[model samples]
Target: MKKKAMASFLIGYTLLFTGSVYWHGQQFSQPIASDAGQLLPTAVKSIEQAEGEKQLQEMVRRANRTGDKLSIAGMQHSQGGHTYYPGGTIIDMKKYNKILQFDPKRQTITVQAGATWDDIQRRINPYGLSVKVMQSQNIFTIGGALSVNVHGRDIHYGSLIDTVESFRLLTAAGEIINVSREENKELFPLVIGGYGLFGIILDVTFSLAKDELYETHTRVIDYSQYSSYFQNAVNSSQVKMHLARISVAPDTFLREMYVTDWTNAKDEHKLTAYNQLKEDRIIAAPKLLLGLSRYSDWGKDKFWELQRTYMKKGNGKLETRNNVMRSETAFMEYESSSRTEVLQEYFVPVSEFADYIDDLRNVLENEKDFNLLNITVRYVGKDEQAVLSYAKVDMFALVLLINQGRSSKDMKQTEEVIRKMIDITLQHNGSYYLPYYSYPTKDQFDTAYPHSKEFFRMKRKYDPDERFMNFFYREYGQ
Candidate 1:
């Protein structure tokens, strides 16, 4: 009987190992690309995921010695080539993740650059604290988030830089410098939203918020009414968080919109442990829906409608702030072989929100091949610190999730439509985000970010050799 049991266990183990190898092999053999799975060469030299600051420094030193360029990556979610360089050293920052410290009294947490917001939440939730600002999703690493100066649903907070207390930066010349608003004030803005060009981020200290219970509510309204609705009913101290979703279907399109609100809950109960909420439980259904939506437009429309009507109808569902902020499994399930989904964001002044939406609808409606999966609108106040800051003025951010084929022809068509979209944004005196694909021309980029000249000039002054570089700089750093 003992021999039979051993045989059974060994056979089961062997099958599991074989299956794991096959799954990994499929993923590896598909292609060499970013998360978007577009604009990639055949392969890269190698990837080294640094485990700590020592390892990261050694890798940078080796690259400097060998005259090899280095690419910085954490989660590699930036659809464009900002995180990669062909035939260059790739320093993967995910393994370097570590939470250094948490001060409950001060309501601040200090963490390694690679630590994700999810990591921070796990430690601070017990203390009844939450992050002040982060992107809608929490899967991105702290370093990557700061690199982009990401924003969140918090209408009051502008961007990640606002909540940042300080950070340690490892320069290309192998010098670790501490920067903040009060100390090393000049370099502070350069590093934030700098896209990791100036140097490597060691760790960051961020301010935290109280973790209180929130009651959520949802309503559908016309796109035209959003501006006045926001002024009259939405923008107030009572509303803690809010976001609007617009229909992408060709028929109704941008005409219809829905607003979801999360306010401070009046009656609260014992909060659930952050670790106990299984993130994967809510992701499977959405992944399956997305896969099915790929087959038909009606399926896609149904998915969006379902999301607004049923999924987002909070109806006073009480949840802790930490629970509402947790998005570990929110956006990590896009694993497709044939097609890839990429993000594009445009920031228009709040007053021009409706007009911008009208123009976006016209282009999306006219472009036959443009497959817009989702559109989310968030309010962001002006942020002047980040040199390449996208939110230069009080604006409404139009975040678009687009799906496209892997072929160059399809990408070209997508780029053409995106150029038109950029043109529309430019006409409205807005700017496009730099984290996505390299679709915008040099002229468009300059128009959007007029500070590029000064930004690159500072980059040259700091790293004269241009040792720190990425695809974004290569294309538009002139």
Candidate 2:
């Protein structure tokens, strides 16, 4: 929560919006402000809102009165907190979380922007319908998911945007627009992956399907023989959910494949409330169980504590559909190094999934300088959020997670690999998702995202004064 470090980042905005008397070293109609010189930590103030349009107006008025750069985020799970733009106000939608309507016949529910995936599940569970994708850990707010275009359970459902039926978005110019496929069709897909560039998402009403159990299955497949195997899994009818999780080693790449099938959700064997005090769900199943541990905004320590508790109940070996469990936390750890810690992840086009994995395996096997941990490949449905939607390639996505320390020399090594990865991705018209931004150069992003120019054009229309922007976007570089 330290606000002292960003005195320099603040200068960029101070200089960018310096034309008018109303500016005063701050943005016009922005709710985030600070003392001249030092950047302040943007904290989430609930503003004690009621459930209606009045609350929305009051919130917008506050942003204008404050006159600092302001942006609205739902769960705030986005890494680096929207680093593309500098100091801006963040309107956290977590407080406005409530289910506005549920149309059972239509198999859809409308919830407040701040409602988490888990929140929606509980609200509609009694009706026997469930969200299709269930993106990531189920803790992400609806608005945040759309902002980032979250995807989950590979080979099953597409990105969360695929399930979105409609949404109410507040444009930068302070206009509320209700968008959907058959309704406001053009604006529909554009806003889902729109990355909050065009507007602030207020509420989302998406479609859902009847709840079904998943018969869990898992196997250890060698990395050398992954491409064809993965292609088959994606197209397979029996394999509803397929995931590629890689473990890095010197000689061999250990890839774990998780495949699941549909079962009866109403079956009594499904998860029931357990007597355990620390954890909520437990699986009473066979050995060789495959459980899921996804990421959540809650503190990493608190999340892992829950995971450990869940693990203690049953072995990680064999698990059944009714017995499978899920925890909200990614298992990425920093390797012990002498200097600083830095992270870099690059996405490769699905068409070249084979080559990307081959090149990475060659490096990790031959080179000792790189200490690799996670190498995940998943699927994404394309959208227009960022100019470079990794979803453009309707195939496999290979991620190389690198941990380079914060030293000058280590950075050089990291940059070299990153540049190469970006080159490989762009060679086949692929783009990286929002994990590590610096890896892809501005030129690379423009190439991957041909329509990105339109995103900037729309930004000017809404945030005409360039008030809602990030460091990456402000520089006109990727």
Candidate 3:
């Protein structure tokens, strides 16, 4: 009888696993929604044509006259409804991509708002130049990154706003004006991290960094010592780009961390050898492994071991700056109708790192609903450039990727965990990132961003009609 019961259990598990794989395969073949199926249907959505400025201006003017809300969007990677309004018009900018100017001598590149980092790297890589600061993935558009003011693996740099030289903005009034530190100065900071509530970012001019070969280094360290370790070695040293991952597997669960540092190779021969940008070829295997980890403890333990081993094996490998910027993202994609992955980032001062980690571990371990896939740690220097800057002081950013179901109960549970996490973040003098879902309440948003009222006030002042609008404003601007 015991043997019969065991056999039945094994057979049931096998069937369930097979069904899941089959369903995933069917979903994966089609277009995946990055908004995690939360996007509300808009009344009008039009792709921005390559016909240029006149067409865009006309469209904006038409919207203003018609009193239709206008929401500008790039890659639309923002999980929050930062790119949409209930019945508003979406001006899709992906097709408007074009590299307008490239001056190798000036170490600067000017590109249309719709152009992505991938496009910029392709244009600048051969010249031995690279983007100064951007997210780890090169798939995001330049304008989107600017709007979010994304920071990256570059420990030496601040956020994306630091590298920006200037840009042209099409205000709600249908007037195009140049904005920068020296010109239209107030709008400079607001629009960088403004979440498209200000105007349409037409084009951008940002500084570039030299593309150099880097020698990779990896080390496992205790969570408590990370703050000190970063200060002494990674932050103050010659490291060019640095990123660390805190183990979220059942065994480690934020107690253990592994850091990867990239420093100048200093050898011209190695530079040429590794100058070519890389593309992920073995995505299927890793994707399977990652998918397995999302469901079971056994899978999580194995995946954690594999991740550490992969990092260890890459130690001392040489890679170019441009190649490192375009890390593999295809394998991390999930295309399920019932489940999806979401990101939440918190920025805490360096002094509060260990305490915050302890609090984070406690909250996550006690939470029964949310499945945290991974946490990647990166250093963000003091950034006062943006009006709604997340990093007020030199800080450490904890980027958490979590898996949650699509059901209403699942969303409520996820919200509870997120709210608890935000409370912890606030306690540690940290600020939560605004690009993710709207789990935090209006009060939480106000507490985290002290300038919330002022930001909204400025928005109304610039465009009283609220011509430039998004769900972000709808939630917090009131």
Error of 1 at 142 (Å): 0.6
TM-score of each: 0.90, 0.71, 0.92
lDDT of 2 by residue, 1-478 (tens): 1243133223321232111011223443333322111122233222133255566655555666675555555544454335223445455567778899999889999988888877777776666566776554666778768876767654555677778878887765556788877776666666666666656778888888765455444445555556666566545546545555555432234333322323233443443332111223323221001111111112222333343344344322332221222332322211222322233445554556666666655545555566454455566545444333557646565554444454667767766776776676666556666533354667776776677787677667556755555544654422
- Summing lDDT over every window of 10 consecutive residues in candidate 2, give the lowest-scoring window: 286-295
Which of the numbered candidates is closest to the native, going by highest lDDT? 3
Output the number of the TM-score-best candidate.
3
Tens-digit lDDT track for model 1 on 1-478? Answer: 2565335323432321110000112446332534444445424456677787777787777777888777787876776777777666667788788898899999989999889988988888777888878987777899999998898887878988999999999888877889999888899998999998988899999999988777888898899989888877867568888788888765578898888878877775545432243363445555545444545577577777777766466687877777777644432245334456778999998888889888878887788778888888888889987888888888889898887877889889989999999999999989999898888989999999989999999999998878777888989994
* TM-score quality measure for candidate 3: 0.92
Question: Which is the better candidate, 2 or 3, if ranked by lDDT?
Answer: 3
Looking at candidate 3, the ten consecutive residues that score lowest on lDDT are 16-25
Per model, state how many residue pairs clash: 0, 24, 0
In model 2, the Cα lDDT at residue 459 comes to 63
Shift of residue 298 alpha carbon in model 2, Å: 30
| Model 2 residue 382 distance off true place after TM-score fit, in angstroms | 6.1
**Alpha-carbon error at 104 in model 2, in Å?**
3.2
lDDT for position 183 in model 3: 97
Candidate 2 CA-lDDT value: 0.52
How much is 360 displaced in model 3, in angstroms? 1.2
